[model samples]
Target: MNLDSFEQLAQRRKTVKVLAQDSLPTADCRAVVQRVIAAAGWAPFHKICSADHRVEEQFSGIEPWRFHAIDADACRNLRSHVVHREAAGKIPAMLASADAMIMATWLPNLPAGGLGTASDNESFEPTLGNVEHIAAASAAVQSLLLAATAAGFETYWSSGGVLRSRELFDLLNIPTQQRLLGAIFLFPGNVTKSDKVEIAESKLRAERRPASQWSRWVEVKQ
Candidate 1:
């Protein structure tokens, strides 16, 4: 398929569970690992990450009060609370086995109020800087997923720990100078349908949301 056709097909694919532990070849798995690093290296904010935590501190210019909004302590607490809620299953072990993880970072640069504005999710007004950072990070992430799919691997991102502890970052040797973006989890082969098959219908029925509510109406400016 051409790039455009592939992109279309990829978008329709859902995030399914992977259960094949030993079926994937070692060489192919290694190739996926290399591609993940390359994708994240080319991901947005690539130039901003460094091995130094001091760099991240320097880049984040928020004042004391505003800085507390994205507090590491609070994030940790929240993540700790949710970690055990996952159903007992082999999916976690399987993911840890066949896939690799990447913790991405962004250059810390934001006006004082920019940090606090995160609490105001009710407003529909555009915040240019936040929007741009989100867009850049999203594009980079989607590119990684699409690239993995093209390579015949399945991938998903889990922000759980990356959103909470600095462990993932520290483990990855991510510099303190870089602001953590998130983590990408990947594996080879599509997850067997049986793994997800049991709950798929229930999830679809219970979790469905109206697309119109999520989609924005576009208007062209002449």
Candidate 2:
């Protein structure tokens, strides 16, 4: 890939959703995920993530983002767990079709020893650090998305419905202080585009207006 193709690659990226059951899951896309995650490290971040939290000990202090990737077997286990919980709405279909799932999380700078006291949604108190952390993580996620796109894969960034639960955190061995940024699901491009599987494109993609409509130059005050 060349710098000139960056615009084309960006344009080629789109949200493709596949709801197939255990079809493309047979492919091990973790290598693509690993390379893309390394590419994601190149994303810009204004603030360095704190490694003081027990959850962040494994990674560099500079990265606010932490990715936990699960393979097909793990996906199947998670699928079973979700089904057993009776909250398996669209999750099972996604997991079944995914070659792998990335549980992307961001470390939040919180009050000292405040993990015990969390909101109803298990989120921490907002801080300037929290905002930057999310931004950095989101940029990293976008880099991964584009990398996956370049690798001939279809990706879905989901809001992680039941995946944000405390039980899941414990099951996945994720620290409680980390917050979910995205539940990235990867599918084989061929399978996703094939007539054999049912695929759904994000309707919001077509609804996007031109850049001029959503962006503008800042006015200068004399």
Tell me the whole-model lDDT of each prediction, alpha carbons only.
Answer: 0.43, 0.80
Residues 89-128, candidate 2: write the lDDT tens digits: 7777777778778899997876786654654336665788
Scored against the true structure, residue 73 in model 2 reaches a CA lDDT of 70
Could you estimate the TM-score for every candidate? 0.52, 0.89
Q: Number of the top candidate by TM-score? A: 2
* Superposed model 2: Cα runs more than 4 Å off: 1-4, 22-25, 54-57, 119-121, 192-196, 219-222
Note the clash tally of each candidate.
Answer: 6, 0
TM-score of 2: 0.89
- Which stretch of 10 consecutive residues in model 1 shows the poorest summed lDDT? 63-72
Predicted candidate 1 versus true structure: per-residue lDDT over 1-222, tens digit per residue: 698897675664445444432333333355545665455335453233212223355434221111111122222333343335445244333333344544444433444444333232112224554455445666666666677666666555545342324443444344333444554545545444454322121235457577887898899999
